[model samples]
Target: MALRSNPTLRQRRLGAELRRMREQAGLGGSQLARALGINPAHVTQMESGKTGISVERLRTIAALCMCVNEPLIEALAEIITDRDKGGWWEEYRGRLAQHFLEMAEIEYGAHGLSTYTMAFIPGLLQTTAYASAVFARGFPRLPPHEVDLRTAFRMKRQHVVRSGKTPYSAYIHEAALRMQFSGPKVQAEQLGSLIEDSERPSISIRVVLFNVDTLPVNHENFTYLEGPIPELDTAQMDSGLDSMLYDAPAHTAQFRSLLKRIDSAALSEEESREFIQSIKKDMERNYG
Candidate 1:
């Protein structure tokens, strides 16, 4: 069996909470270990996210820390238990990075998701052909099979939007609507697909037009996910080199501000549909 590489987000969060509780109780690792009848090193490992904690141990620790809220304790316990089990993405483990896997799991668990794209369509909305073309261009040296696997993974993620599990909102730039990474035909198809998907009750698509002077043009891609707990809301920013996930209140607030700016600059639903249809007509005329 493959050894676990590092603690997942859930594990990390739980570990942080445990450490916080211990510190609040004014107990050091050794003291807590003695009180719980566990080894100091074991307690240290759990606090550092280097070791997993069982449900029973978690309850004992919570009680020892004077935690009275059953809901919060249960939530933390769920994170520990859930992390131990394999998620559906485990099947595609070798093909995708750990960050992408974590994002996929979080997306599945989110109650709502909002995205802003400046360059290209977000992966969740891209058609297979569009996704393939984008991946091919970005990874020119990648093998065809690898590109195919990436496309498949992206396609699978779109289910979250199609199904009613999580509501999603997207704000896209007008440039992206006109940009043709693949041939015009593929681009046109992608735009049409977006329009159709946007009509879904759980999906909202708004386009920031070129004439919108209020729009912020800092070219960055971001995704914000909201879960059952307010603290679980997170924002992800793409830095070209890598993606960074932010959960700090300040960072999340900044993302929320950016999203609001984009939303304010974007065309309304009817206007966006008209704009997309106009672009599709032009693509047909030029390419067909």
Candidate 2:
């Protein structure tokens, strides 16, 4: 099979697991390929997530790895054989960055999400005006039409918040709230929207204050997504140029620990509401 140029995060995760299994079995790609009757390059491709594996081949590989758990093998086989191509982002396939598209797919599939943002409000919670302003600042030379289209795409993704079925929790630093992305008026509106969202049962918003002196210095924006299955839990870290998706146990454990620390340092639900309201009032007093 021709190598897939754009592999999904799920595919990459499965490939990582397969590579770990092979290493644990003390087998090299060439030796494993010989046993499986496939080319070593193909084995490398599958393990690196550049190519997909067939269900039968996946089972055979699992057996060779001494993975006796039928359910685990079946789960791996299912991800390998998955043919679902439906996603809301298909229309913007060539327009947006690959990292944004991947994030959209994973966010849509997640059962729950936890996010920590220190610089700006998370995209899912951003108002259209605020988002547009931020995007415009980043893409200063882009044509007006292109800017509007990108802004609309971002606004459309906000529907994930109101879907009601899935839950999303965000721990935002006080610095993000203080930043005036679109001047005082837009900032006030954004803060009001956050307060409104906090009232929703499925959405939790907390502020991490600078005065609190939190131990973990969260400088990057990161999100932890809980999938329907335990094995599929994933984390995405924003790195400006390109985002990174991690699903290993070690990465997941680190995120879980950070989540605990953030939750502890953040203001309580009631306190968050009051804090946001106070900021909004102050902004109005100074700007209005």
Tell me each candidate's TM-score.
0.86, 0.90
lDDT of each: 0.82, 0.84
In terms of lDDT, model 1 sits at 0.82
What's the residue-level lDDT of 59 in candidate 1? Answer: 91
Worst 10 residues of 2 by lDDT: 77-86
**lDDT per residue, candidate 2, 1-288, as tens digits?**
678897777777778878878887899999899999988998888988999877888888988988776766776776766645668887888888777778887888788999999889988999999988877777346677777887888887777777776799999988899888779999999999999999999999999888977557554689999876666788889887679888877888889899998898899989999998998998888798
lDDT of 1 by residue, 1-288 (tens): 232357776676677778877887888999999998988987877876778878999999988888776776777777876776776777887777777787787788787999988789988999999999888887445688888988898898889988867889988888888888888899999989998988899988998877878666464588999856665568888886577888766777777888887877788988988888999889988788
* Regions of model 2 farther than 4 Å from truth: 68-74, 139-141
Distance from true position, residue 146, model 1, in Å? 1.2
lDDT of 2: 0.84
- Quote the positional error of residue 172 for candidate 2 in Å: 0.8
